[model samples]
Target: MISNSDISKVIAGVKGQINEQDTSLIVAHLPLLEERLQYLAKSFPSETLHAIAIKTNPHPQMLKHLVGLGYGLEAASIEEVNMAMAAGCAPSKIVFDSPVKTRSEIDCVSGLTDMLVNVNSIGELNRFPSEATCTIGIRVNPQVHTGAPEMFDVSRNESKFGVAISSKQEIINAALAHPVSALHMHSGSQMKDLEVQRGALEALKALADEINATSSGKIHTLDIGGGLPSEPLSDRTRMAEYGAIVHEVFADSQYKLVTEFGQWVHAEAGFALSRIEYVLDESRVFIHLGADFFMRDAYTKARPFALEVWNDTGEFVQGEKSSFDIAGPLCFAGDYLAHGAMLPATTAEGNWLSINGTGANTYALWSRHCSRTVPKCIAFDGVHSSIWSERTTINY
Candidate 1:
């Protein structure tokens, strides 16, 4: 069994090998990622299909590991589809699930392997190429929003994710009329409620039954698109719970039960390492190191709960435990990552702080805001670590 001391040693050893000037660094815990995938695989051993959503981090090593474990890719874009292919994932092992697709993107994906196209609208269904023999999936909107309102507001009618449950029959009828093959549903993003997810599965199973009754060809696949919660929040429902839910919902169906879990698979396996550059005053600490890149990285805004910060130095100085704001090196006022966050009393500059929820290549979401260079990423197999990505420098 690996103890905390062992993990700490591995972290220290990896940190020693990297350049200190590289402010933003993401480290992937490969062993942990593999372990979670293996656990999921075992839980749903009867499942014929398990696809990893490619949007989370898309670290090549992570994708390679998933492919090695006999998992498929659930890609939402052409780039992700290409990445999966480049990583040795065959077309048959990929599901192209972009509900809102451009004509050109559809043109590019057409005739590419045995891909599953997830259609969100009747217009998209009408646009599907007649010559393509791909399995077609209709993404049903559960009309139940499950994540942070700011991040994925699916409860409101304004949200444009999938076709509503009220319109599921029409969608299935259209697919059957077109002679397409599968059914799909995605309640919302960052889904933490098992009940909501289960409800979606129930709705999907009903849709599948309806399709099977109407169409001569069987509804072969039932894809539960990626939205599983991760990190500090997913504790509400264990991965095993999710597996059991899937099993119960599709108990007698012959349909291949497929789930696209990206965040839950890779979130815990990554750590964002940042160093304290300087402290402004006793009242405010300004240890500017790396940028988290995406505005969505703030868990409080994305998941409805604030993330707890950990100081690696183990220094506990006493001051007011009041809220403190954390900001990146960017120039805009919106550059703040965390605001009104509680920190240690004696948090000082030059102390290393590592955010536990982020993963390697997490900074890939960073744009050239304020012309800041992108941070580097490193992969660690809990023992053997290597620089997978280099830190970018400002170039004219």
Candidate 2:
């Protein structure tokens, strides 16, 4: 775990000739990554089910490592499902979750395995292939919103993620009438409160009880979809707390409980390294580096209340720490990372700084609007290190 001071020291000794085209290098501590995963796995164990949401950082090697550690994959698309499979994940260990599914994607994965599908509507339930032996899970909206406004706003009544709890009976009726196999529910992404999770679990358990009562098919699986918050700066919910919550919720139930987490598993495994391109002002500095336009990689996306500043050197200049803005090299004004934040006074031009505690595949969400090549990715397994991905130079 690199400390903020260690990062400051690294920036203090930058001697390389930093350029705009030069790839901003990143180093992933695989041992730490493995350790974190193992800790979470052991903390929850099979008693409290856990699955890796594939959307966060789907590098093949990362997925392979995670799957090898007994974590299941939660795939949102056919491509993600294929990626998980290619990474040596068995279809039985994959959960095909998406509110909207195309016929082709459904047909392709239909006969693969008894993977869980998170259904959101009756139409999706009706469209499921009857021949496919699937453990069906319905995403119920608990209507209990948490997290930042951006995250909370999406879980509002108008949001299109899951079916309302009031309408859950309709979903259950449709499921019982069809080839349903399991029950699932997700509140929203980046949820921090335990009560929110409890609410979601209560809803799922109620549905499970109803299914067990009225239907011939057994509800053997309960998937508590992952929205576990991963705030790099603070601990929202500890692994043990999450474990306790799960244990309490399913104490009386016989169903297998499963959880899908993306950010929680990979957020602190890697860092995004960039160099300070130029100092925009005395208080505001511009540390320019290569990155996709995704908010997850940049802090600005998650915390809109915080200010961002640019710094040429990763270190902060003396007395100018409180007012700074960090921006990427993209042409758009919204291509900023952090703003109005404290920085080191010693920061200068040509210094390399990292978007500390990020993942190797942070660029997965970036777009090619300005035709910039994707950044490179490197993985370090304590003693040995290797380049996991080469820099993207193509302009398509």
lDDT of 1 by residue, 1-396 (tens): 123443454456666666667655666777777777776776664755778888777867667777887889988787888888888887778888775688887877777757887877767877767887777777777777565344555534555877787787687768777746777776655676777778778987887788788776478888887666674323344677877887788777788877787777777677665566654554444444324354464323432222333344333234557566666676655555566667665566655555565642255455555676666667777677778767766686
> What TM-score, over all chains together, does every model reach?
0.84, 0.84
**Residues 1-396 of candidate 2: C-alpha lDDT, one tens digit per residue:** 445544443333332432366446554667667766766766553665567888878877778888887778888887898998899887778998876788777777777867887777767776767887656776766666655256434456777877777787687777678777777766666677777667767777888788888875477887877666554322444665776777777777788878787766676776656656676665555654533634444534533322222245544435444456777777767666766656666566765556666662365576666776666666666544466776767665
After the best TM-score superposition of candidate 2, give how far the Cα of residue 294 lies from its true spot, in angstroms. 4.5
Clashing pairs in 1: none
**Residue 52 accuracy (lDDT) in model 2:** 86
- Kindly give the stretch of ten consecutive residues in candidate 2 with the minimal lDDT sum: 302-311
**Please, what is the whole-model Cα lDDT of each candidate in the order they appear?**
0.67, 0.66
Return the TM-score for candidate 1, rounded to 2 decimals: 0.84
Give the true-structure RMSD of model 1. 3.9
Clash count list over all predictions: 0, 27
